[model samples]
Target: MAGFHLPLYRTNLIRSSSSPAPSAYTKPTVVTQNLSYWNSIYSDIESHLKKVIPIRDPVSIFEPMHHLTFAPPRTTAPALCVAACEAVGGNREDAIVAASAIHLMHATIYTHDHLLLTDRVGREPESEIPHRFGTNIELLIADGIMPFGFELLAGSAGDNSEKILKVIVEITGAIGSQEMVAGEDGGVGRPAGLLHGCGAACGAIIGGGNVEEIDRLKRFGLYVGKIQGLLSEKSKNEGCEMELLETWRALALKELEYFDSRKVEQISSIVGV
Candidate 1:
């Protein structure tokens, strides 16, 4: 749910293509009818996720109690993407596969994030987080979970292994210092936005798209990050200093509004609405 994305329209990010204008949004086309293909990919993603994630204590790693409001809205995003793709005559199979992979990737990232924090705060020694030599569980949970996320994304995405590996290498390398510096310096500044953008860039690649695809993915990623920021702040309000709460809320809303606006713009372009 954190943000980092590439622009679909940003040619510099990828080798440009003169591929025919993407099929009309209303054209009746099944780019791929292999429902089985989608299902198989879903199974592959899910199985890999299970292996990496600590399923036994899902809340600690999955949807931890701290992120209640984020779950529903975040879950809706990919569904919206699927519908948008269907309207655009894009293959539902590919769309679903992308959605499944993206969502799984998000979850995987979140799980590692939690582990990193717990380890940081010394809340969960087994987490093996480098910092937080001696802190409480609450403190550990308070931190963001993005670093572990990219690692999992790179290691697990087996379908388009080569492309996934490249994206992982790039995203992971860029995000690492950003995360550590922000954490140590108390500068969670723009984390959600930065994360959202990365998500867009990386997700587009995983979905077999070029720069134009990345643009759409970036907007989508920003929206997700904003939503997460809002909900996470809401969940952490009681524990946060009163002065910080409003600041966090403001950041969340700002991120949300920015993405919401972008979502409209991108969807209009995609659907020719």
Candidate 2:
């Protein structure tokens, strides 16, 4: 797999040494710090995932697995896990391995979903994986990757056995037959909500959050998931969508009331409300 890289921090950091700085020219320390923080999280996740899913002797199988897993960093599931951990005052290192596991599960789901789309030839031609690789092999690869995700969590648990075990159980339940898979068939509403809520709750547990805090964070994730589902629905009415988004956003913020202001801001930034 190619080396991992973070998206460039957009703000320019350079300053002219000779020029007298104006009052308005305050340094973007906060933005810089935030960028650096997330960059480290992304890097850690990539490094750990690469270690768990390495390129090796089985050229065909590993190659496709690598391609799907190491594609462009489009999803925020891993970052959300890291953010949730930090929200509850856990160190990034504690959550990094679990976050990678979450990402692998996500990739597995997507790979399997894409393969299961029977009408891809007609409806999603551009989105189809290369046909040269047989569908059965792809399915097997997806199935195989799922176990490796759990293996990563188990191996990385170290001294935090109880916490990591809880995370594994939570993640497994979230992506199991009743939740994520159900969503694939019935569309997003309750399934998506449950899945994200489960993820956030697991992250909170791994991060050592109190029972109440974990519940609150789970509610926050559920609301965020609902918003996502609503937005994705083609039949959604604009007025109703806005109302639902606002309602969920408010509820999520209410849950963050007890958290530190900095942490609340970071969570809000991740939720984009």
Candidate with the greatest lDDT versus the true structure: 2
- Model 2 Cα shift for residue 183 (angstroms): 8.4
lDDT (Cα, 0-100) at 210 in candidate 2: 92
The TM-score of predicted model 1 comes to 0.38
Q: Please, what are the lDDT tens digits per residue for candidate 1 over residues 163-246?
A: 667566535542455454455655442255444445445545555555555555555545544444543454434232434434
The C-alpha TM-scores of every prediction are 0.38, 0.74
Q: Which 10 consecutive residues of model 1 have the lowest summed lDDT?
A: 8-17
Name the Cα RMSD for model 1: 15.0
What is the number of backbone collisions in each predicted candidate, taken in the order shown? 27, 0
Which portions of model 1 show Cα errors greater than 4 Å?
1-48, 51-162, 179-190, 235-273
Whole-model lDDT values for every prediction: 0.40, 0.65
